[model samples]
Target: MSAGAVADWLGVACLVAGGLLSLAAGIGVLRFPDVLDRMHAATKPQVLGVLLMLAGVALRLRTTSDIGMIVLVAVFQLTTAPVAAQMIGRAAYRSGRVDRSLLDVDELAEER
Candidate 1:
């Protein structure tokens, strides 16, 4: 009923949601049929899951002192995850690990 109680509940919910997203990412990586799909699984949901958990921690702590660290972590995760995924996906494609049939566009192929 109190504001503190609401904040606590919200923080817990965010953590749970993040955990579920992490689980989904793991399952997707394992079950996906291709390297590109697996890279997608490893990056997309994983980034959001980390950000959500960081947000939950921030909310639960209710302080400004650690905000910088949390923001740094989130920014680092957001910036690196997609780039890493793209590089890995490109490597998979170039190495002939990705299934050609699943791709709709092949601009890399066109370039070569």
Candidate 2:
């Protein structure tokens, strides 16, 4: 009934949701048929999962310095994940791991 208890419960809920998202990402990576799909599965849910986990940690810690560090980590994860996924996708495309038939727009096709 207290505010502190509410915060704790919220944090625990976030952690559980994050864990589920991470598990979904793992399953998606394993079940997806190709590189692009796999990368999609790996990046989207994984980033969300990490962010959620960090949010849970931040909520639980509830200190300025710790919260700042968590924010920094979340920012880093958000920034790097997409870039890394783009690189991986490009690599997969160049190496012929991507299925062209599934592509509705092949913008990169003109680049090469």
Candidate 3:
């Protein structure tokens, strides 16, 4: 019933929700049919999950330094995840591992 206890509960809730979202993203990685679909899985939820977890940690930690690190983590995830995704996508495109059935457009490969 205390305010501090209520805040702690909220932080725990955020952490749990974040963990669950990351788990869902992992499931999508397994369940999706093709590279693109799976990449979609890898991209959105991965960022969301990172954001959520960072927020959760910041809330729970409740310190200036923890918050700075959380912001850094969020920035790192936002920047790096897409670059990695692009690399994987390009590799898949070059190797013809792409599932064309699912692709309406691919601008990566040099067209003859």
Provide the overall lDDT of each model, using Cα atoms, as 2-decimal numbers: 0.88, 0.93, 0.84
Best by lDDT: 2
Task: Give the clashing residue pairs of candidate 1, or none.
Answer: none
Pick the winner on lDDT between candidates 2 and 3.
2
Instruction: Report the C-alpha lDDT of model 1 over 9-85, residue by residue, as the tens digit.
Output: 89899999999999999999999988987898999898889988988888788878787889999999999998998
Q: What clash count goes with each model?
A: 0, 0, 0
Per-residue lDDT of candidate 3, residues 1-112 (tens digit): 9876776788888888888888999999999988878888998887888788778777778889888988988999999999999898888888888977666775664599
lDDT of 2 by residue, 1-112 (tens): 9988899989999999999999999999999999999999999999999889988888788999999999999999999999999999999999998889899999889674
CA deviation > 4 Å runs, candidate 2: none
* Model 3, CA-based lDDT: 0.84
TM-score sort, best first = 2, 1, 3
Q: Flag clash pairs in model 2.
A: none
TM-scores vs. true structure, each candidate: 0.93, 0.95, 0.86
Off by over 4 Å in 1: none
